[model samples]
Target: MIVLKNPHLSVHIDEMQGAELRGIYTPDARNALASYEWSSPTPVGRGASYGSSEMDWLSGYRGGWQETIPNAGQNCVVDGVELGFHGDASRTRWSIVDQGADWCTLETSTRLPIRVRRTMRLDPDRAVMYIEGHVVNESDLEIVFLWGHHPAFPSVDGGRIDLPDGCTIHPDVNRSGDLLTQDSPWPMAKTSSGEFADLSEQPALGSHRLLYVTGNKVGWSAVRQPDPYVSVAMSWDVAKHPYVWLWTMRQTPEYPWYGRASMFALEAQSAWPYDGLAGAKQRGQGIKIKPRGEESSWMTLAIIPNGSGTVTGVTKNGEVTFKSSEMH
Candidate 1:
């Protein structure tokens, strides 16, 4: 692991392939990050990489993506279908392309025969971190995958998500929503108070991060703790990505923290309702790239103190704002 420090903050990142962010700590603040669980690097049955099934790549044939694509040596498919989950380009190692006091860039090539470059910039003045992902389809064939950000935060009470206007929160239906019998209808109704009803009453925890999907073309989301010392805001280019995914889980005996304690990941995705491919066909909202063409998406996460934080989604100079007070 490599620790990069500045006057206002310090970030820990793995030196290995992914260059993953291990932790982000602010020494001037009282709320420090706690370590949490992640997938192990060990390869397992059917060529699954990582210790847990959730992180492993599953393919219809043996040896995974390595066998399907030329010069590919890792699993990158699920049940023989090409999909980007368990983190896009997560299976491959990333190389540091650039770094400075406040910014760093990493690049990697994937088994989909795609190339992705990520830039992480830390603004000490604003206490925010910006991540921009630029992806290129290097193959002649059309490539389709689900691309989304997964940033885990420390789960804690008093933390809630805020959405933009003309938007509603509904059950995932494919996953947790099955736990409910009614099967929530899409585009839920918002109360007169301008807040959507809480579909799940479970309180926030240091270990669990609530996940939600949004249909709004412009909006932002945030995860705030009552301690007043810790909070994070995420905004995206709404014109490019109209959806968001929130992921949070508690640490258990079965999982160990790779860095900070329990964390929450409030991910901004490219499409709502479904992953990229499904959204493209069903919603007709997907972006298309020419053979070997490139397209990029950007998301920003800002850390602010107390209830004064704000998250805004900006696209083509237009903005959709979400503030701390709007969180339920």
Candidate 2:
């Protein structure tokens, strides 16, 4: 386990277990964030790699946040080999290459010829986490990559989702209870049976819904709950990561889900359709890196305490703006 602190918060990363974020909680802030918890449950033991099977994949899950590369969905072929859920990034360990008083960096490489480096920064004055990352494609051939940041938030009965205008939804054809699969406007969609679903609100599905969203010129999402009023917001570079995925499940009866899981994962991704790189490439939305080339991006997340207001938007500098009104 690796820990980084900034007087107000303590961020823990499981360096040996897929380098996933174990948790982020306030230590001395004594504010609304003090009660914040990890979205993902702790792992049963050291996680096993996704061995082209759901059991192997989920056995390794210790999720708070994870990085997915080359692929971001279920088992599929990437560069001729079957890549399971979220690819090797979340299945491999990362090395702690650097650390200091308020920041730490992690680096990992994949057999797929990609190297990912992540650095997280915190400060004494704010309840936020900043992550900057760079990816290098060291292979000789240009390759399409489906990369994303998988930050799962615990489900709440009154969970409300917020996004910018012009956004539309694309339901994952592979998942069940796809209420809205077409290109509808943001936050509202009609099921195939013609029932309307408020995308902004998370409900009891009895099943699951996986989808990708477009029109993220304003790249951000917030999951707000009631009672304690603690809110979590995630913001990323829309230009680099143009797509966002909504992996909201309730009582999913599948093997990995086991009919006893509930979580809302608003994934900020760089590719599409969840059909692996081949599907993303066929649709021309898949991103590719030139031989020996690299790309960089950053994401910022905020923990809003007291949670009395709605986060209207977040600036590039990580300033969160909100109003007194709640969406739900």
Candidate 3:
């Protein structure tokens, strides 16, 4: 575990696990992101075989933050190479290229002819973490791939998800059978029967939903948890990440949850349709990297203690300002 700390916040990165962010802690030692201790053994890569990626991914998931690269969801074959569940980066060990008191850079070479690099820098005077990263295609052939961030936050009963003004929401699966089959504008979704359901408001326990939100005027999202009076916010480049994948689950009775977890993930993505790289190719979506080309972006995360109110925007420096001073 590589730890980076400033006066106000601390970050944990697991070097053996894709350099995955294990946690972000406030002054009170509370982690803004979700972390869990599952009953099963830790998950590890078992080579790229059919149905193995999903099993390994869920078995080893510990709920911090992961970078799903080359592929986002499910296991699929790309260019005759099997890309694991979230790609090889999430499970591959990363070599630390450089480090400082408040920042570190790690690099890894994946199964495909690509190299991934990520740098995490903690603000010295604020509760903000800055992440800058890029993927380089080493092969002579161009590569079309899906790149995204997966950060999970604990879900409170009355929590709310805040996005920019002009966004729309579409669910991957309507297991709840309430959300509309089509896209609806932010904070409001039409049910199959034509009634309105509040997409911003977190649902009750035993409920789970995976939604894809797009058409955002800007690239930012904040999840406010009222009970703890803390808000976890993320801001990124809209061009690099055009979509936000919202995954919410409360004590889901399934293989991974088993009625023991409640959390939501706000992911910044470069492509659409969670069917992995193959799906993205079928839909003509995702980033296309030229031979030996590189793609990079930056992300900012802030932990606000009294930021449960409506957040107007989050700056690149990690400052959170509400709509009014009263909300503070």
Candidate 4:
């Protein structure tokens, strides 16, 4: 485990395992990132079957944050290269290129023809962590892929999700008994139960949903927990990541959860659908990179202790401000 600390926040990362972010800490929350009962901290050997990538990815999923690249979901073979579930970027080991008191740089190459490099930096006087990185295609031909950030936070009862204006929700899998299977404006959606449900409010356990929040004029999201009164705000470049994947696993009865998990992951992605690169390309949602081409993006995670239930905005530098009406 590689650790970086400042006066206001602490950051942890596992360099050997996809450079996975283990957790982020502030004075009010021990670890603000979501966790799981079955997730392992150490690497697990891969299974023989190609479809085993999901299990392989989950075997060591500590669930703080992960960098999904070259492929975002599922397993497929493109150009004779097998892309595992969530891709190789988060499953392969990364080398530490540099480190300091409150920052570290890591680099790794994937089974595909791309290379990734990222730097994690903690602010000196704020509860914020800035992640800046880029992915490069080193092969002699163009490559199509999906890239995104998977940051899961612990589920809180009565939690709320905040987004900017002009955003919409596109449901892919709806088990929440709420939300139409079609696109709905930002927060409110009509449910089959003959009532309106606030998509912004986190649902209770035993309900799960896989959806995409698109039409983002700006890239940012804030999850506010009422009881602990903590707000986690994430910000990024919308041009680089136009869609946000909202995954709510509230004690889901799926393979990994088995009715024993409760967490939410707001993934900022460059593509649509949970399908792998092949499927993404088929739908014309995959990103293309020419030989020796590189693309860069940055993200910021900010924590507000004892915050109001709303966040008006979050900047790339981690500056956070809450709703004025809710302020004391």
- What's the TM-score of each model vs. the native? 0.69, 0.87, 0.93, 0.92
Q: Identify the leading candidate in terms of lDDT.
A: 3
Clashes of 3: 1
Indicate which candidate wins on TM-score. Answer: 3
Worst 10-residue lDDT window for candidate 1 reads 61-70
Distance (Å) between predicted and true CA of 254, model 2? Answer: 3.2
Model 4 residue 36 CA deviation (Å) reads 3.4
List per-prediction Cα lDDT, in the order shown. Answer: 0.51, 0.74, 0.82, 0.81
Candidate number with the higher TM-score (1 or 2): 2
Residue-level lDDT tens digits of model 2 in 1-328: 8887876677877788667776777664322221223333333344544444455766555347888876777657766777767777787778989998778899998757889899999856887889898989988988677778888766667878888777888777666375755767877777877888888888675747887898788888877777544577778988778999888777677755665667778889988767766677778876678999998888988776544466778765668777756633
Which scores better on TM-score, 3 or 4? Answer: 3
| Model 3 C-alpha lDDT per residue in residues 123-177, reported as the tens digit of each score | 8877889999889999999988878899998888778888988887887763434
Checking candidate 4 for backbone clashes, the offending pairs are none
Off by over 4 Å in 3: 41-51, 173-177, 192-195, 325-328
As for lDDT, the candidate ahead, 1 or 3, is 3
Q: Compose the digit string of candidate 4's lDDT tens values, residues 56-115.
A: 677667567999987887778888889898989887889999999899999999888888
Question: Where is model 2 more than 4 Å wrong at Cα?
Answer: 28-51, 176-180, 323-328
